[model samples]
Target: MKYDFDTIIPRRGTNSYKWDTPEEENVLPMWVADMDFHTAPAIVEALQERVAHGIFGYTKVPETYYDAVVRWFGNRHHWQINPRWIIYTSGVVPALSAVIKALTDSGDKVIVQTPAYNCFFSSIRNNGCELSANNLIYRGGRYTIDFDDLEAKAADPKVKILLLCNPHNPVGRVWTPEELRHIGDICLRNGVFVVADEIHCELTYGRHDYTPFASLSERFQQNSVTCVSPSKAFNLAGLQIANIIAADDEVRRRIDRAININEVCDVNPFGVIATMAAYNEGGEWLDALRKYLWENYEYLCHFFTERLPQYHVLPLEGTYLVWIDCRASGIGSDATTLRLQEEQKLMVNSGTIYGPGGEGFIRLNIACPRKLLADGLERITHILSKN
Candidate 1:
């Protein structure tokens, strides 16, 4: 079935964080991770059916929801997930906080790769844990793990958990299996726990492969907690559902206990139905979306190369967020975002939010209609050219 990815959806005045927040009426929001496209038909249908039943009350996560999740990872990524190992959560970010609180004590240190998802910092901080950053080595317009540095941080006794982004945000790297194994080894050796946030795992493009940290080895499985959801893949962020997969019984028990204590164990009716529908019936829609997103990436690259050669766009391996190096123009990401909003009425994420190595960069969300992407690019070109 052909999905309508090209249609421009009107989200303005819809209380959309991406579109409605800016005070400027003319501003076009190209920030935030949520896509502008509508969710898959299957998800919509499932939601509609549930709404038709009209009983909105307390809910229990059915056995079918767990089964669909198990089937999804096994069939798509060759990672077999036992239904018994899956724990429900409202969202991955909240789950991270809960996991941190449950596993590590206050004042404990958490290891985070720099230039990571901005939420990693907050999640660690909110739990009263200090951040031990192993900054990624950025060179030649790409980012790589500084393993020697990572090992050093892991060796610290206070560092009890490593909060990991599997296909890292902003820099857009789908970490290879070897890199993941090396990371797991270092964490395991140092007696540190791993929380693999794989929310964006299914959105990879081209030949890039995403390795789930838990699927690496029995030892790695025991050492890691994998967080995944259909939220990002099927555009169901509003549904607020995710899974925390822990193969170790003890780890699962602690997380499960944390879920109840935190009062986040209750699954919403819509999230449960939408998630099952997405995993079981949304494959074809996802496959087509990946192609469309890759093409959008290609278009952005070509536009920058031909019309605005000074701007450097990092190669995108996964996720629809495009990380661009704007240091050539001598503008920091915050300044760039400001000028774009004021000058061209374009809004984007300042890279500084992603942490240490993210200076002088900007992240643009390309998961929208091509017409919108082209317009944003032109506006960006105009603003940068003036600067």
Candidate 2:
């Protein structure tokens, strides 16, 4: 079935976090990670059927929900998930916080790849954990993990958790199995538990494939906690559902307690229905969506190559977020974001929010219709051309 990714659905009046956040009219919001395209028809139909029931009550998370998750991962990613090992949560962010709370005490350190998803920082901070940056090396317009630096950080006794982002956001490199094995080995040797955030596992493009950190081996599985969801891939962020998979029973129990204490244990009914629908029937739609997103990325790359060659557009191996090196604009990242918002009515994220190594960079979301993406690129050109 052909998915309609070309239509520009009006979202401004609907209280969308991405669309309605900007006060000015004609503001193109290419910032937030959520896609502008509609979710799969299966998800919409499943949701509609539930809405027709009209009884919104506390959700019990039926076995079918677990079956859907287990089947999806087993079939799609070749990662067999036991239904007994699954712990449903409201979102990946909350799952990370709960896992941190369960595994570490206050003041213990959590290591994150620099220029990471900004929420990882907040999750660590909220759990009373200090953040240790194992910054990714930026060279030749690509990002690679600094393994020696990661090893040094992990060797610190205070560092209890390494928050690993597979198919890393903002930077956009999908870690290969070899890199992941090396990382797993270092964390294991250092007694640092791995918290793998694999939410973007399904969104890789061309030659780059996402490797589930825990799926590499039994030893890695025992030492890791993986948080996954259909939210990012299925455009279900608003549904607010995610899962934590732990092969170790004790680890799962402790994290479950933390989840209850943190008060994020409850999930909305829509999230459950949408997740099952997405996993079981949304594959075709997701593939189409990925193709559209890849095209958008190529178009953006071409645009930058032709009209804005000074600004470097980094290669994106996974996820729809594109990282651009904007140092040539002769302005800091924060200033660039402000100028884009105020002058051109375009909204994009400053690289600084993602932490160290993010300076003088900007992250753009290309998960929208081609026309809208073109408009945003033109808006960016209007502002950066002055430089």
Residue 19, model 2: Cα distance from true site in angstroms: 0.8
Per-prediction TM-score to the true structure, in the order listed: 0.98, 0.99
* Candidate 1 lDDT by residue in tens digits, 225-282: 9999888888888888999999999889999988998899987999999999999999
Using TM-score as the measure, the top candidate is 2
What's the lDDT for candidate 2? 0.95
Q: In candidate 1, which residue ranges exceed 4 Å CA deviation?
A: none
Which model scores highest in lDDT? 2
Model 1 C-alpha RMSD to native? 1.0
lDDT of prediction 1: 0.91
lDDT of 2 by residue, 1-387 (tens): 378999999999888999999987799999999999899999999999999999999999999999999999899889988899999999999999999999999999999999999999999999899999999999888899999999999999999999999989989999999999999999999999999999999999998978889999999999999999999999999999999999999999999999999999999999999999999999999989888999999999999999999999999999999999999999889999999999999999999999999999999999999999999999999888888
Q: What's the lDDT for all of these models?
A: 0.91, 0.95
